[model samples]
Target: MNLNRFCYFLLALAAAGSLFTPHPWVMWLLLVNMLTVVVYGGDKMAARKAWRRVPEITLLMFGLVGGWPGAIAGQQLFRHKTQKQPFKAYFIVSVILNISVLLAIYQLYPFSSFFTS
Candidate 1:
């Protein structure tokens, strides 16, 4: 497989991994992978102009809904980070925001307490 496809596969694996682990560390890894794709892929002109304009909200939604891996991988595979503009900024911001939200919820929620009662 090409480097692009390989990168995407890694991203998918990361995303799938997040679903099973409760640790915030997993999300961190996924975030790193996504950021890597966004930065490197954008610099290399990997995707299209229109697709590169994908909104930060979309990325945030994906991360929030447990699809960070796919979203990140899709960006790299589709070469959707060419715009060196909003795509990069929005992606980074959204990933950080999403991870923060997930971590916050995990720590504050009474998940274990409720399950035991």
Candidate 2:
């Protein structure tokens, strides 16, 4: 298979694996990531069709909400938003901010709290 398809396949496998995990947030993240991928694909198609495109802010919001993995994968698979200067810069910032927030949360809360009620 091609590299893009391979990447998507890997992501799908990871998503499937998350189903058995005890952490509810893992499932949430997987769902959000899948949604992000769909949004990115839709935006790419819209751009090709000369239709109204998804806003950069919306894309960034998805990434900020823990969809960066899918966003990056979408960028590669769809060849979307990888070249725009402002969007690229903001996308990187969003990913960094998201990771930082996740790290902070992990540091502040015990690991069990993330999964336990």
Candidate 3:
């Protein structure tokens, strides 16, 4: 299988694990995955000039759906980051969207609202 695809699979598993565990361990796993992808992707993007041709918006969408790390890795491995305009903008927007969702969840539901009182 494609290494990038494999990494993404692992990321998905890790993210889903968080839903069940909701522990620091799971969060750590998620963070590691995300950071790995981001740093690696940045390096890859730096190498390739195809930055303008790729669609970071699609990648960002993946990130929003617990695929950010994979997107990051794909960006690097594919060497798709050099054009600084759209990629950066879309990346930021993706991050903001994720953060907003997190904040909304925290503020709207301090505890388990899906369960009993």
* Best-matching candidate per lDDT: 2
lDDT of 3 by residue, 1-117 (tens): 644455456556665666665464446446655744664565456446444322344455556754555655666576555357777677767767877876777688764552222
Per-prediction TM-score to the true structure, in the order listed? 0.42, 0.79, 0.51
Per-model C-alpha RMSD = 8.2, 7.9, 6.4
lDDT accuracy of residue 41 in candidate 1: 48
lDDT of each: 0.55, 0.81, 0.57
Clashing pairs in 3: 45-81, 63-68
CA error at residue 64 for candidate 2, angstroms? 0.3
Native-to-model Cα distance after best TM-score fit, residue 44 in candidate 1, in Å: 16
Candidate 2 stretches greater than 4 Å from native: 1-22
Q: Using TM-score as the measure, what is the rank order of every candidate, best first?
A: 2, 3, 1
lDDT of candidate 2 over 1-117, digit per residue (tens): 643444445546656776667765777697778878987998899899998777788889878878999999999999999999999999999999999999999999997888553
- What clash pairs does model 1 have? 46-79, 47-79
